[model samples]
Target: MLLLELVETTQTVASTRSRLAKVDALAHLLRRLDPAEIPTAVGLLSAKPRQGRVGVGWSTVAAAKEEPAAKPSLTVADLDAGLDRLLATAGTGSGAERAATLRKLMAAATAPEQSFVTGVLLGELRTGALEGVLTDAVARASGRPAGAVRRAAMLSGDLGGTAMLALTGTEAELDAVGLVVGRPVLPMLAATAASPSAAVEATGEASVEHKLDGARIQVHRAGDDVSIFTRNLADVTHRLPEVVQVVRSLPVRDVILDGETLALDEEGVPRPFQETMSRFGADAVRETVLHPWFFDVLHIDGQDLLDEPLSVRIEVLERIAPAHRIPGEVTADPAVAERVSQDALAAGHEGVVVKAVESTYAAGRRGSNWVKVKPVHTYDLVVLACEWGSGRRTGMLSNLHLGALDPTGEFGEPGGYVMVGKTFKGLTDELLRWQTERFQELEVRRTAGTVWTEPVTVVEIAIDGVQQSPRYPGGIALRFARVKRYREDKAPADADTIQTLRALLRP
Candidate 1:
């Protein structure tokens, strides 16, 4: 298929907010793809090419400029072949070879196709069709059951591969895809709730477990070989020998465990989230060691418990790895749930996750069956600037640049604001339009992407917490920061001080 066809469909998907419209556009495009091109096309549209990241960064894409072709000629196969060339040169640091290939590819693509390819390469595509939506479209186009396609994708951790099979292979072959002991599966996700009691109310008779402020890991073991994967399904087995050792110590010959791992202090309290992430990004073991805490078991002794109830999985997990289990209690009482929440906070944990005991393991889905409740720290921060949005959010003022008042001038002048972080989340279309119009009126200067505004707009920002980072002048950054609301009632002088945010960096 022509690359322009896919680009047009992406535009269609982004132009509309309706799920049905997006699915219809995607399914229509999928039905037109040849068997050989289905996987590449799906991967490109999903912004998760089979070749993964081909070592291309924003600077390379921006620097290797090329005028768009006047007419469509590049095929999906042509694009995939170019990426294959890129993958071969990955980590070779041959910028000339990679840039030549990328510029040539861009020169062949039309304007729309060029933009789509750039977005895919940069991992910034905003087609509005998430994996679930695309899976539904794949099923719709192929006449396969949605559940079968979803399960295959969730288990295999490859939506592109699953789409190829669902479209071309028989229903028997697609359905036959099962939990493989050595392969990484998509970890189950959770929805957010206001409080533990609210979460328990959402998922009755729940397992209220302490929510560790750490990294999510999925461990798969067969015989003596064990592998650990991050939440994104990236293999980190070599970097996490401690996790592999703990999983290998289990009695079961074949098992799959899902849990969190973090470096703990001598007091056994969990370390900061960034400290654990630093180890995850390491090439090899470091002085900082991460310990595993298993909360749920997916497979045990060749038995696939993915379809089993949470209660059953917890029982099996407790039997197999009781010493490594996360602390929690199974209770229906709101008071008991509140106690668990308090206990988690007192233990230096994040919060509590209340999960329904009867809910089956719904991998890759953030259903209401499991709800996470964490306390949020809110502060009124001044909006220093706003960057231009992308794809569907284009032509809007999004991604607010936040700053905190540095009243004592410890990091800057007295009564000045120090840069903290930026966030584009928790925005509605109404808010987007409001900011686009309002911020431009308050603009003091402009750049290619951002409009610097007068430091008079005070916005209420909610953050999970603050972490130590040298990127900001304050020596800290906001973690999981999102807009609670625009603080129209508050002034820039009333914004929280940099000292207040710095205090969060303390234990």
Candidate 2:
């Protein structure tokens, strides 16, 4: 099929929020797509070629500039080649060369195509149609079950390979058809339960472990070489040398262990979530102090345990993993699990993740098979300021200043209040307007476009615990701090006190 056809289908899919309609459109597009073109098309769809920082910056500005309309007859190959040329020439040439190249490419395409290509390069294609949606579409077009396609695709991490297998009868013909760590595997998406009793009822028999307030890390070790990847599958090996050292020290070779990476206090309690994140950045691997806690093993000694039950894999994990592989685990009783949960909270940990004894590791699946039960509710926070939001949210609120009540702070000197690390999540048009308006009215300090708001609003914040922080005005910082609600009815004075927050420090 022509690139324009696919682009048209994308437009149709993008316009509709109805998942079923989007799926149907995608399925139709997949049916018309030449299987051989799948890889190149996917690559082109995901490409953002840049030769160097200079070229990239220039091209970004050039692409942003408005240009005169030109005839539209560009093919996908032509566009791909142009992008490759732009990236290759980005830092190597003058500003004029970069601008001319961008203008030429822009002139060759229609407005819609330019928009689509731009979105793809920026990795912000928000059509709600991801790999899963595409898998379903392919299955619908070819009359195969979605599960079969998902399983094959997950094991290979190749949509084209999975598509060929689903369309043509070649899965049986292919060799090496199981999950491998270090390679991207679609994680099993999870479902939610309202309460602990509901979780118990869903699983029947379960093993619960302390749900830590840490970064989700996947460790893939092959012999002396070890690599650590974040939940997003970005290579985080450098930022976590301590974790790398621990994994390299393991007796077992050729293994993929899944777990969390935490920054612990002197007393061994997990530190603030931001501290854990701070260990990762451009120089993260070089300087950040991090610790790993292994929870599951997908592959060990050339064995793929993804199809095996959780009970069997845990046995393998416990055998090969290092000692002190996280704490507070192993129990079938719900009451015991509850005790574990309480102890986790009492000891300044997050909560517990209850896993079904017979549950298999379902890649990219988030089912009730493994349920996370936390003592506190966490909200998605939006960074209001670097403390600047984008566009209108700019200047005043860039770094999000997170606040939670100290139900227990009054007993302490200066009578307690604490600020958590700033986050930028859950911002909507309305919330941005309210915040922007409020900040303008209550600006205490202004730097560039940013304005620090008066500490007037008390947001109900949930967190794992409090830890020492050198950044915030308050000496302490929040761990995994997130908004639970806007405490419109409660005054800041009535918000949880510093003493209440200090009560959670169980080190």
Candidate 3:
């Protein structure tokens, strides 16, 4: 199929707010693709390339000076080949070479096609038709059950591979794609609960385990070879030799363990999330040592336990790695679950994850069988500015520039607020319209995208926690912050202090 066809399908998908419409548009596109183009087509639709990060940044894409062609001529295979060449080129003076190549590619594409390709290359394509919607399209086009396609995709950790199989291969072949020891399966995700007792109540009889504030690791061991993968299935075995050594030393061979790894202090307590991440991707010169803590076992001794219940998997995990297992207990009692959460926090951990005892592992999807509970911190912050929105929120004032009151006169002048981070989440259309009208009235100045406000609009913001930041003036930034509401009754002086937010960093 031509690249223009896929680009048009993406535009159609993004033009709709209804998910069913997106699925229908994607399914139509999928039906037209040949088996050879499945991988590239799926990758482009999902806003990822089959070759992965070609090192083409916004500067390279923006440097393309050639005028777009009036007609569409690029095919899917041709586009993929061009990206391959872009990825293969490296070292000194490759910037000019890449810019020239991108210009040639864009020159061949039409105006709309250029925009779509630029979005895909820059990883900014928010068409609302990514994995979940694309999976449904694959199922619809292939005449297979959605559940079967989803399981295959999750098990293989490859949507493109799953799409190829479901479209061309038999149902038996798709079912044969199960958990392999060397390959990484998509780690099961968790839903959020208000509290541990609420999580326990939601899951019934549960295994509440300590949720550590660390990088997630999925270790796959076969004989003497051990491989470690992150939650997104990126192989990092070489970067995590400490984890590899621990996995190699395990008593059982041929095992797949799902766990968390964090750098611990001299007292053996987990360090802050940022401290752990500082060494997670650093070179070998780093002094921090990451310790692995396993919570679930997916495979053991050549037997796959992903289909088994959590109780069965926990038994195997406890038997093999009792010393490194995350602390927890099995109970239906809400009080017991609350105590486990308290213990986790006291041990310098994040919170707790309550998992259903009878639930089998559901990969990729955030199943209700598992739920996480963590304390939240809410503060009255002042809105310093707002940025122009994009995609569905185009032309609206979105992404608020949040600021904390700096009363100590450290960051800015005596009583001026300091910018911490930006957030556009938790806003309805009504609220967006209200903000567009109100912030424009309070606008002191304007930029290309942002409108600087008078810092008079007091808003309530809830965040997971604060992290050490080098960009913000307060040396801290909010994590997962969202707007609760605009506090009309509160004044800027009555807002929370920067010290109040920084204190949340303490364990």
Candidate 4:
């Protein structure tokens, strides 16, 4: 299919607020794709390239300025092959090569095509058509059940591959896709609850386990060969030799385990998240050694446990990696679950995850079966600026640049707020409209993407916590920040101090 056709559909998808409309448009486009074009089409629509990061950045994209071609000429295959060329280079002096290659490709695209390519290269295709929408599209196009398509993609850990199957293969063929001991399936995610009691109340009988503030891991073992994957499915087997050795020591010859790995201090207490990230975020070795902790098993021997209940999966996990199992208790009592949360906190862990005892693993999606409860800290912060939105939120002020009161002038003028992070979450349509109107009146200046405000707006923000950061002036950043509400009752001076935020960071 022509890239322009896909680009037009993307515009339509982004223009619509109704998810059903987006799905319909995408499904129609998917039905017209040739077999060879399926993977590229799915990848582009999903806003992720199958080749992964190809070393292109904003600088590379900005330099690729050229006049648009009069008519469409690029094919999906053409762009895919060009991305492959960009991905081939690495090491020193690769940036210039990548930039040149990116320019060449951009020069060939029309104006709309260039815009689409920019989104793809930058990984910011905010079309409101991610995997969830695309999965429904595939099911619609292929006349198959959405659940079947979703399950196939989850089990294979490849939406591109799943799209191909749905378009070309039979229902039996899709159903045949099952747990492969050596392949990493997407890890099951948890929904957030207000508290442990609330989560246990929702799940009835549940397992409340410590939710480690560390990197997520999915380990796959077949015979003596072992591979470890990050949450995003990146193979980090070489970066974690210790994790590999530990997985190899498991009694089962063929198994897949879902867990976390983090560095621990001398007292066997979990280190700060930054310390854990120092060990995890780099390819090169650091001084800290990360230890793996297992919480659930997806596959054991030839038996696939994904369809089994969490209770059954935990049984297999406990039997195999008894030493690495995360601390948890099986209980129907909400008070007991609350006690478990306290224990996890006292033990230096993040918090507790309350999981339904009878729930099966729902990969690649956050279901209600598992709920994570974490202590939240809310503070009155100043809105430094706002960024223009995309997709359904186009032409509206969306992301809020949050700042904290620097009362002591340690980082800036006394009473001036220091920028920490940005968030667009937890904003309703009413809030978006209000922000767009209110921020325009408060705007002092404008940039290409952001509208700088006078920092007069006081808003209450809730955060999972704070993390040490070198980017922020106050040496801290908010984690999972969301706008609770605009605090019209409070003034800028009454906002939470920067020290208060920094204090939430671990020692």
Model 3 — which ten-residue stretch has the worst lDDT? 407-416
In terms of lDDT, model 4 sits at 0.84
In terms of lDDT, the best-performing candidate is 1
For each candidate, what TM-score against the reference?
Answer: 0.77, 0.70, 0.77, 0.76
Across residues 225-329, which tens digit of lDDT does each residue of candidate 1 receive?
Answer: 998888777888999988888888898999999999888999998886557877877977799999999899998886899889999999999999999999999
What clash pairs does model 1 have? Answer: none
Candidate 3 global CA lDDT score: 0.84
- What candidate 4 gets wrong by more than 4 Å, as runs, is 90-100, 377-507
Which window of 10 residues has the lowest lDDT sum in candidate 1?
122-131
Backbone clashes, each candidate: 0, 51, 0, 0
lDDT by residue for model 2 over 1-507, one digit each (tens)?
Answer: 455666777667655556688678877766666666554454432221121112333236435555534545766666556666666663445566866766676666677666665554433233434455667877787677777777877666666666666665554533336676567665553343444555666787776777787767788888888888766556778677787888888878788888887788888877866566556544634444677888888888788888788888778877777484656556666677778778878777777777888988887765779887765644322222334666666543534576543322222212123555665554555556666676565444567745655455655566666787777555566786655444332334344444445445557
lDDT of 4 by residue, 347-411 (tens): 89868999999999888777789988777666779998999999999999999999997654567
How big is the positional error of residue 81 in model 4, measured in Å on the Cα after superposition?
1.8
lDDT (10s digit) by residue, model 3, range 185-270: 98887866779998998899999999997888899999999998877687878778888888888899799999999999899888
Model 2: how far residue 79 lies from native, Å: 3.1
